[model samples]
Target: MGGAALAAGGLLLPGTAQAAPRLTTPSPVALDLPTVPAPRSERTAGSALRPFGRHLAFGADPSQQVVVSWQVPDAVTAPFVRIGVQPGDFGAPVAAEVRTLVSKLSWQKPVEDQPPVKPTTVTQYYLHAQLDQLIPDTTYYYVVGHQGYDPAGQHTRLGDVASFRTAPAPGRGAGFTFTAFGDQGIGYNAAATGHLIAGLDPAFHLHMGDLSYANAGGSGKTSDAYDARLWDSFFVQNDPVASRTPWMPAIGNHEMEPWYGSDGYGGMRARFTTPDNAWSQSTGIYSWRYQNVGLISLDGNDVCYNTPANLDYTKGKQKKWLESRLAALRADSGIDFIVVYLHQCTYSTCHDNGAELGAQQDWAPLFDKYQVDLVLSGHNHVYERTDPIRAGKATRKVASGDTVNPVKDGTTYVVAGGGGGGLYSFPVSDTYLGHETGNDKPVPMVVSERGGHEQTVKVTWSRVRYTGYCLVAVDVTPGAAGKPARMEVRSLTEDGTAVDRVTVQRG
Candidate 1:
């Protein structure tokens, strides 16, 4: 079949399937910031206070190093992490660094006629400890606390112990699985998606950003309805699975807090412990290698059209860093595949912010140039996938049961933004990937979001599109020169149904 043309208004030819109507962007209405009734005293019992938001992250090397992080309600002295192979015996404790963030919110009175709501100060404490020289592919138990609140205490039960396994040794050619999604907030759907991701027992998980939506208004305005308490609730909701899995992430637009320090990642830096390899100030743009897969997490906010706050923060430094990283990874003989992830997708047919032109312009060429295998993203709160694309167009159609060789063809883009946010609709029919058949007509597409104009160009590259809370689970098998590696990607719905699947081969 012939490809669809980019018609006027950045849409697919009219009458092609249409996406559901765009969601009403939440306005920055006057909102009262939650008040903390009691301030944290200078002295507090540590051992009795258990950590809530326990999470894991990888350093420059996944196998040799892992970063353990968590949050405490009050300031605790000498916060640290204890790690050991055996559950019962946690070896010597490694000192953790404490970073305290105070969010100052000045909410304007909704009704000028009434008394104005006073400003509020919300202070939070976060702790991080890096565990080095860890054994590969070995599970290690850990506990987080300071002098008074040690989870290893006799009173602390076994259930309080959290554990994680390091990545497999490099060039081991071992098989492993990982999952990814984005746009999750404090909701039932997000919780449900976390439960589903846990079922997969992935080695690590990637969150493409828009984490909690604590700032209901996604725009990066200081006056945009700020509530710091929502983060506490959101972390608790995610603690079930994130406490165990290595939760790596890329910066989303919502994470941009202009009210805070440099580049709006100030809050993010205090919350999570990421590799200290970002070009800009703690933007979470870095690269790492796990066995045969070389992974990169880009800061999509730098190249996003919808959120132009802090535009050109890197002034093309990020793009240059990405190209260098991709080239190095591709040249490595042990590396079999290159996977890049970010918040905004480079290709999608979602109604609101379909394919972001900034992403395509800034990074798509680099992906094509490097022959990156799979690009994962989530921002539109839906599931969408593109066929093998080259030069901003589909080189060939990809369907379920199809095996694609990224080394031979181009990269495949995936939008797994349905991690518990409200579902989005296709402009036309709901054409599921593996379950439904496709129509010949063109579909609605958003071409750009410049000056509030969301332009779209309809094309046949949309191989799979599903409207539901979903995520991507990928099982990877490493291989040498003679034997090519295989990545089996499965898109699953909330009910554990397999919406779509594809095999990507790389040598």
Candidate 2:
């Protein structure tokens, strides 16, 4: 650390003592501030229009740090954030830290596909602040937003105040709970998923992507054709659940740009703050370690298949980082296990349609080499469990000297795409897969096209892999790397009722 670092709320300033670090952001909406632009309707109804947070998500900045983020609504407006310890109310000097969203950014074309063009007319602003040096396992309360904004429908008095408990730090703890799911955008099913999560009250929530669905209640109009949809309005409707939880996320095609190039994941990216200076600094591809669990997120939006350049920039970099991360973890030998999270799937019942990534063939080897414990992903929608294996072959050898049963105690693949978007039809199709040989190595589990001699129409697994939603609760019992982390996978229905449960016992 440096003098500047120390000046950054770490300790006392040059003259006086420094207060504890506060992580907070100003309200997202500005009302009649006479500063920002007004909507065409300007239906600034109900004198008490209040601005509240829109997509509240949290990520562990270590047991000592917590990153909080939300959108600020308009570019012209700035955020007013505050933070403090729990068991105490916010706004109390003992608990509050305030900061201004005064940072500016000038974007250069990404190295991907670059072409100079006019700057975007509309810019999205994000509010970010970090709560640091916090005590572990303690509750923290926070509130965000302003008192008046048109769309909020009314003047806001008190912003929503939510509390969360910090996870125990490494070496100082043994176990904890957190929820992981993907594809549950916003809608009837998504709302139900949210309820289940709220009930669980895990330390944090990770959405595997596909979080939007059409009409149940959202601001956007035509979001319903699968991946893009959400409740009534994908953006607004999705806020209820997210506003209270520190929702960490993964990506899916739903987050991709309709145009496929410029500023993809537009609003979503702008609305969240990720570790910008850490390893894999790109928001889409970042890594954060919480307690004993280290999560690595990827951007499968690499877009092209088999091409060296594409692999080099996207998957290649990810693979290299994975290797480095694994090597470092192995050398340390202290963490309970290494868990990898991403949006694409390696094991699926949907089969070949998603085979273009060749993740099973390419990434499986790395997972095995590193002895990764669990690999969670979305995009397929439905849920799947893979027999532990190393690169298509089983871990044990058969009499004939062939790998038997393929997978083992070391690692298992999970397809958790189902998060409320679209559901895919199960059973893989061989005929449809014939086309994939160019990009995919056929897995025995995929369904074939020819069953009946007369009429052969195979019911291939479609988006189900990505559509089937569920929340996985991992109970990290005491152990070492490669050891099973007692896990309970729960699949709930549209009403938040538990429908399926799978328990993985430790070896």
Candidate 3:
């Protein structure tokens, strides 16, 4: 266990674009990389300490591949990962590829008490071990540590052998469940929601964005005071849940700190091991499949207006790639549902967060044209769901308890931002629970976006709006030859109550 002690694959590298070269799996021997040492100043953060923030992500392929990643505060001697089916008998250990991020912050400069030194870069090492050809739907025990602190070695008795299960075989109709939420910062509610998600036992967890709020400045401009050390606390806080479940995340505005790199996701790319099949170098956009569902993680910052940091950074290439992917997925008979997740909400009523007009212009029409089953988003720190929509209009009055067939009713947009961050308020009272529960009168809601654009609309389409920390659990039941497939999406509160739920059926 690194940081705070918490209980914690290679398929072909698929290119993001159709024209991109398909990456073949590298030879096993090709995974080796030379070791790097921790800087003098940053070594105090714990260079050779136990690993922490252990989490998982899918490689190009979900079933036969998985990426195990963790963080070491300082430089490690020889960081590696050992895996096996048994709890304590890892036969061979695979060396982990280490990537370090050094943040040059003024506050990190040596103080009066310390030896006078040049501006010290607060260095943090992120280690990743790619496990390929893993058995599908099977649990494997693994441990992450360096040379001296080896968990599999005889001298060390570290009881940090964690386990993770690979995704079920794609198109196998294995019937798996996945959970998702965004805007999860470090807090009690976020930790509670994570535990609830783990209780639900989802195969993977989708963190739409705004992961740690480390880059607290929502705007992508230069931070007032960027603190790279915050990730140490946030990852430790989230270890209870993310340590076990695969924490697949999308890039958010907060993740785009201008001090880091172009488009502000250089820090993110260093930490996460998301699929790089896309053409975007930021590693913000990628796609993967789990059973009969196709999940696309988009870079909402490319279309977000409030932040405007990296708007159009992709030069509309992400949209083109997305359209191509959606069209291909829709044409595939085996893919019954397409769920796209991003940071900004494409359609949300909260005036604070507003609607992501860039997302609307770039991807909403494509979602409508392809009839995407579900669009999940964050940025707005509340749980909000739109009625089945087509061309920015309600296709069906999606009241709670109504089962919607997206093929006929269009797509349902979900704003699941309440994942531990401070909740934001809505301009109008909530329609579902606001007036129905003896609160203020449910006034007509106004959807606001960038450029001071606001539209006062009736509340007939906003079916479920819950203001609290929650996680969305989606169960995909594949349909047979003659039967229709069913998906039950539930927004569970920190207390494990289903605050909002919807059933989407497709034949």
From the highest TM-score down, the ranking of the candidates is: 1, 3, 2
Q: What TM-score, over all chains together, does every model reach?
A: 0.88, 0.66, 0.86
Q: What is the lDDT ranking, best to worst?
A: 1, 3, 2
Give the per-residue lDDT of model 2 (tens digit) for 32-52: 343443441132332232333
- Candidate 2 or 3, higher TM-score? 3
Which candidate number has the best lDDT?
1
In candidate 2, stretches whose alpha carbon ends up further than 4 angstroms from where it belongs are 1-49, 53-60, 72-78, 86-88, 91-125, 146-159, 213-232, 258-266, 277-281, 303-312, 394-408, 428-469, 480-485, 494-507
Report the alpha-carbon TM-score of model 2 versus the true structure: 0.66
Error of 2 at 118 (Å): 22
Indicate the TM-score of model 3. 0.86
What are the lDDT scores of the predictions, listed in order? Answer: 0.78, 0.48, 0.75
lDDT of 1 by residue, 285-394 (tens): 88888888999999887777776776677888898899999999989988888999899878887777677788889899999998999999998888888789999888
Q: Which RMSD values do the candidates have, in order?
A: 11.9, 11.6, 9.6
